[model samples]
Target: MSLTSEERAYIRSQSLARLATIGPNGPQVRPVGFVLNDDDTLDIGGPKLRESQKYRNARAHAEVALVIDDMAPADDPIAAGWGRGVEIRGRAELLTLDAPPMAPDFFSNDVIRVHPSRVISWHIAPEGQARDIV
Candidate 1:
């Protein structure tokens, strides 16, 4: 599986994430709505997605990172790491005309497919342990 049970659950539970891409200027990060595809890829779509800088960046760089995080109860009552987070690093491809099917709310047919190479998770262990899945 591309994702562990916990990672899948965490991803599906969240509605929004940040996608980072590199361009000639530098790294660019933006909030995006994404769907986990059956083929273990992430589909990021929205209105005018093809015209966005991120889309152009992905087409050029291919390498990208997606971070999904949220607040949660921690194992330690007073620990600073009281939140859970996951970062997915992978290659991204821009799908313009023949993109995957998306939800009705998706504003555009264009999508960016993220094929994960590494997954890093934190504050999700039984006792706030961290793990890496590759």
Candidate 2:
């Protein structure tokens, strides 16, 4: 599996992630809404996505990184670790849907699809074990 059951659950529980891309000047990072598909791919769609610099960057340079993460609330006395996260290093491609976008609430049909080549997870598994897939 591209992601373990626990990892999938962690991803589904979150609503935001940081998408990093290479721009003309340097690396650009932004908060983005994403959809994780059954095929283990990530779809990032937004209004006017095609006009954004990120889209242009992905089209020109496919390499990218996405990070979804959170820290335990201070009140959660029994929570594991100081943080939990997943980092995906992958190749991204520009794409469009036929009608509705993957995230229909406030996104458009234009999207960037990320096919993960390597995954790094920390503080997600029980016993706080970290793993890497490359």
Q: Using lDDT as the measure, which candidate wins?
A: 2
Score candidate 1 by lDDT: 0.82
What tens digits encode model 2's per-residue C-alpha lDDT throughout 32-87? 98988888899888888999999999988899999999996665443544788899
List candidate 1 stretches off by more than 4 Å: 73-81, 97-106
For candidate 2, give the lDDT. 0.86
Which clashing pairs does model 2 show? Answer: none
Which whole-number lDDT from 0 to 100 does residue 86 have in model 1? 83
Per-prediction TM-score? 0.84, 0.90
lDDT of 1 by residue, 1-134 (tens): 27777678778888889999999899999999998877778988888888999999999999999998888754444334467878999999877645435564656888998999998987655554577877
Q: List the residue pairs that clash in candidate 1.
A: none
Query: lDDT scores for all predictions?
Result: 0.82, 0.86
For model 1 the local lDDT of residue 10 reads 73
